[model samples]
Target chain A: MLLESTEQVSRWHERRAAFAELDPSMRAEALQRQANSIRRDIVRMISAAGQGHIGGDFSVTDVLTVLFNVVLDVDPHEPRRDGRDIFILSKGHCAAALYATLASAGFFSPNELATFMKPLSDLNGHPANTKVPGVETSTGPLGHGLPVAVGAALGSRIKGAPARVVVVTGDGEMQEGSNWEALMSASHLGLDNLTLFIDRNRLQQGARTEETNALDPLDEKLAAFGLEVRVIDGHDFRQLEAAFGPSTTGKPVAIVANTIKGKGVSFIEDRVEWHHKVPSTEQVEMALEELAQ
Target chain B: MSTLLDTAPVDNRVAFAEELIELASHDDRIVAVCNDSVGSSNLVAFRERFPDRLVNVGIAEQNMVGVGAGLAAVGLIPFVCAAGPFLTGRALEQIKADVAYSQQNVILCGMSPGMAYGELGPTHHSVEDFSWLRALPGLDIVVPADAAQTRIALRQAVAEPRPTYIRIGRHKVPPVSPETNVLERGRFALAREGSDATIIAAGTEVSKALEAAEILAGRGVSVRVLNAVYIAPLDQQAIAAAARDTRAIVTAEEANVAGGLGAAVAAVVAELPKSQRVPMRILGLRDFAPTGSTDFLLDHFGLNAAGLVRAVEEVLNGD
Candidate 1:
């Protein structure tokens, strides 16, 4: 049987402690308001840039919000702290959500969000670890993040540290053969400290993932590769927070977060053409209005 | 001719393995990663001593390289050992992406490189290792001439914090470098100095080039022989000096003539002032070697001492 640490038990206890400091009915309201603010920030940033992967940005917003707000053991002020949990965005095209989430968590100043993708800006189209304080590795190529995450997780394990490694990859990007190789090795090494979260938005560059090359039965595939599988609603903050709980088994965990492309926005949600389509001025106003409520 | 020599003939692979073991003993973080070829790579001793540190990925070259990158990511200095053909040919993309582009500090050990597996056919021969690897940036390619140079090169690679490829030959070679010679990157060794012509060679060709120099000296044709251990960052100073002083230059290696030592030397010589430039001849594998013994294959490919002398004479005559 896996034993839960005293520190972890106390952290679980602090969840209630934080709630006790708030009014009984205000706790849920506070979290909902914070989530809505993060979504609004994501919409505003992507709309101003006029060029971003708004689909994945919206789909993964709540997941990132929950991780930054509640789940992860990270110190935004000290991003390079040795004991901090590493969060790697393998689906790097979703820079808007990551930038907003990072800024909201104070990894960098919130004012820097205005410079995303400008000429000579440190915030390029994709997140670069050399430029961003909280980014762990530079990733845009598919199938690169899991291997690197495996390395960081293995490093934490070798050093006997309690830090966990979380990597988020796209559903379509799993077609690269290197991901399976990493999966097998991570499972064989029994890296229980590692967690892979698949952003199953179901849309790739050109077409729907099923119309391209299907990655359905993703849970079975990951389980076959020896990872303990957890299917969750990616946009649900409560589900994401629960899935981010400490692993009870001494094996790597794979959370297949089912999400819709362009989630939260009315017209673009679940639309295949919106994988990287930037919203126009009118669309941006509509999105901001929807998110403001 | 039959006088007794005190030293025994040693294969460079043994030297490579022994040096690696010594380095690992001092640094516990040094790990050996192989594609199920521990015996062929002479890593039996390493596996026996440190069983936990040896990661045998079992016949998957791609996975072997990726795992090496993973190990490097975690602060372990991994020496990925495998046959030359499989290591470079089978997993070229992995080498390019994971090791070179990712800038992972993993030592890629190509065992039995460059047609050393004679009669094993084209599939087994690694004649394209140099051409394939030289194209990739941020990787140091070192083909040691003999045991001493191999040891020095291995030690230097371990101490340096970068990606490197060490080509270890299966064929036996006579020790050329003096025991006092320290190996440094982009530094060439002048085995003998002459003014008539310069013979630039690496790997097994270095000894043959020296032998050819002795033959040319007998005929009063003074020749300069240079042993090029580091191929990528070619010693520009030494190569430039050879071009300036020598009447002509002859480059030889156990790889294709397209992008190997010959192409590298040609690139350097082409950039020099026309008046200072010398006539050149690149003697190496222009095509795949026919199935035969290693000795016959070398002779067939014009890689022996006699072939080197003729090429030097031909280049000297401007033919």
Candidate 2:
């Protein structure tokens, strides 16, 4: 029932190749279906484990889908290949979503999803780069990913490598001043190769981002920090694709991905209490059914 | 490793920068990152020679450390230089998560460590770096005794890439360690050998401990001195042997007595075979220092040669 390590690697490569070679017209639908399937996997994994941030996972699923299915140029066998585009999940609390995406995209076996946060699991609560493939850097603490992205971008530039770096952070996580510091550095270095996505789900752990700490005029604030800011509906494939393109402003790009927490299921979406709450058995069935539809 | 024949006192920061520049010149993967501490970290010449390689991330310590980790993630060996207080105190979480837990190939160069920032007071003093960094697993903490050790430590870090922190002291220190003995990881160098008493020291305090040993030798109290190179992976063999062979011991460091070279040696000594209850003394700054120079601060807190001699004598005679 379990594939060997080499078999698992090849399986992911085949899956990734299939999706990567899909027809241009069918790209959006394929990404949506993959995202929907990954969502179901996340719901099951967290429900079985009884511990996870399912709300943020639901909110940030689409961008991750587009990244793995479309934007990024990475290989499961050679995750750290020279001149490969790097992607990091700065809001690492939603690791279930990342694991699901990586599994579906063929980085590893989908069977590994059962081991999420289980005993001796490589899938830690936060994304650890050393343990996980396709994770460029370990990021769990707020404001960590942007600086790393800046550094990677600079490294690529200095080495004459055309590799690009893309990092996603939670809107609630942006209140950390370190992100601003990194923004300053990225702008100073003129890292056009770096792209930052702020999952603007508007909800933090306890309450709303505005109620806890206001990040109003988020786009303007990013612009002030010398980034090329773009606001888009986070779940829209077309908009995400447009915003995720190469930076024309010759500055670091920042996309405020306006989204609703717990986006897919009707009951969970826009609710504050579902930030990390596990659904009961009945709720799990309902959520999965809703995601399937 | 280059041989050191100069007996004149030298600042380890100078050697650190020179060694970094030399290493970076040959290896294009080697880069430097700082938080607007280029001047303070003595990286002016490095920045000049390799302008494109020195990444100045303004005055942000957390970002500086995270950037260092990121660069290392991309296969570039980064020597992240910053003032010791800010690098260790401000960006501790980054150091813990990014470098230590993740095991990034980062060489964190903590410049001007300990009371080297003397008159700036406790706000700028990094006396707690040992205790703070020692708690993190997989992060190697090295405190080189002099200029030669500083250069060797840098080369060793590059030779065997891992998450490491090296303390580059600002205080001027005379060379005490010779070039003959290999710089082994987690092993203390025998600075002076004797059988009557032992003094364990690191960083700027190694020279002071040697001076104290000479005075103790004149008083008919032969003293053994150990330069504690690796603070985290402590040389337990040397520490246990010293405690077993010597009548008394004194641990000195340019750090707090609470948790540093002294605390590390004590922890090792506590695990020794139960028969040897060696009387000991830990000489370091016990409280926040007053307005003074580095020498004044060391003498004020009883960390000078005379103070170390007195502490060793008391431990030897009291037992």
Candidate 3:
């Protein structure tokens, strides 16, 4: 009886270790399927709610997908895990994508996606940190995430911990002078552990970024501000994975992810009207079909 | 009155720095984010002690507040110190977005609030801070009356993790509360007690309200004084009780009349029971103050003891 019990314990331990050793490639593939499902769900939710930032949502979906799936060392069950990586969505209007991603990553019930903008729901028009389990900070206004990311990075460093801080911001949101101020401080402090990803959709609320306020020399600007800049196709998962890895330079990294607004759905791609425009029933069905494929 | 030996009066800003330094000594999470106002904020010692902790983000007020919020996001207790005018006016959007809406645990220390820099003109005066900041939700607005209150408020601010704005007054103020008096949020300090009328004040005007009460007492007018430390979460209970017991109420603040302490009191009094309702007179800047010395500006704006006494008398006569 003792020998039989010993054999059973060893078998359980081997299975546990094997599950823990799952490769990143396999994890990324699982996350990709989840991301596609999340995108489909976002379209349905926005369509049902009759209001949402669809363009930015579609643009940042893949970015959030990779972070929650591959890069971040976090457990949804322990959302506030002390040693876990900190992820702040600075451009809070893109909350539809974040909410979907968090839900898929098991931060909350996937059914909660149905309550995106319902009155009195924990999920509101914007992501509120106090209400949401996975949300690190409440953000709606632009140019806020970077600084908080820097602080989180600094705090981790203060405690002599290996946890990293990542903040995703919209390119249009960077026009606010606050982002640069944070950039300067992050560089000055040499916050190598922090990574900033800009969802460069090349469009703002009213017009194209170039027409509204040109950030043509964005890479140069970030470099001048002392960050090690890396330009990537935001929707490309492989490139995002490489860019988000541990930094070598003793300075903050800015991944200028080139993205198309209203990605995945062809009709609304690069359109300004879709910034916060909820799709009709027909459009939602079409979006779901496109994401499903 | 008999002459007493006058000691060098301590500035509340120094007290603010001292308390912050003390907190930082123990808590590694305590970080100071500033807009290049180390000397002005009296954080030179704080910077020297914790060089790594002091984040001087140049002269950009908007960025300073944003960075402070960011620091708070990572589980760091950030004390964002800067000139009141620049901190509030320059970065009003950041305060609204990152600090208030985001609900970051940031201690926004508004150095030298009110018309402290009188000769510097209207642009420098933080008269609109109370109104502008009070309008935002999930933020605590603290205008400390003296050095002791400044220390207590700063300590309490860190202990209670929330978005808080501390208006550190530049104008000299005499300590009104007892040494043992613990500063509590949304609680008014009874500086003096009487029955005929009540004087409500905050920041530098608290001491002036006390002086006004003494002057009114000599003139056969029984006056009560209440020090309003937390302006946003106004001590409604104390205010309602004062309005109920007294025949008249007078509110004094070194801020604008539109949305400052006076406006807050007026809103509460309007909702009070008709039997307990009393006549109220608000004393504050009605228009852009003219350029002059700090004392001259306070007198001109009717934020002095004489102004409070006059406002109380007007309320009494009207009632």
DockQ per candidate:
0.26, 0.73, 0.54
Off by over 4 Å in 3: A1-31, B1-9
Prediction 3 TM-score vs. true: 0.93
Candidate of highest lDDT: 2
Per-residue lDDT for B227 in model 2?
89
Model 2: per-residue Cα lDDT at residue A190:
90
Ranked by DockQ, top first: 2, 3, 1
lDDT tens per residue, model 1, B72-156: 7656788999999999998787787667766778899999988888899778888888888999988889989889888888888
How many steric overlaps does candidate 2 have? 1
Query: How much RMSD separates candidate 1 from the native structure?
Result: 5.7
Least lDDT summed over 10 consecutive residues: which range in candidate 3 chain A? A1-10
Provide TM-scores for the models: 0.86, 0.96, 0.93
Candidate order, lDDT descending: 2, 3, 1
Looking at candidate 2 chain B, the ten consecutive residues that score lowest on lDDT are B1-10
- Point out the higher-scoring one by lDDT: 1 or 3: 3
Candidate 3 local lDDT, A231-282, one digit each (tens): 9988776687889977778788999999999988899899999999888888
Candidate 3 lDDT score relative to the true structure? 0.83
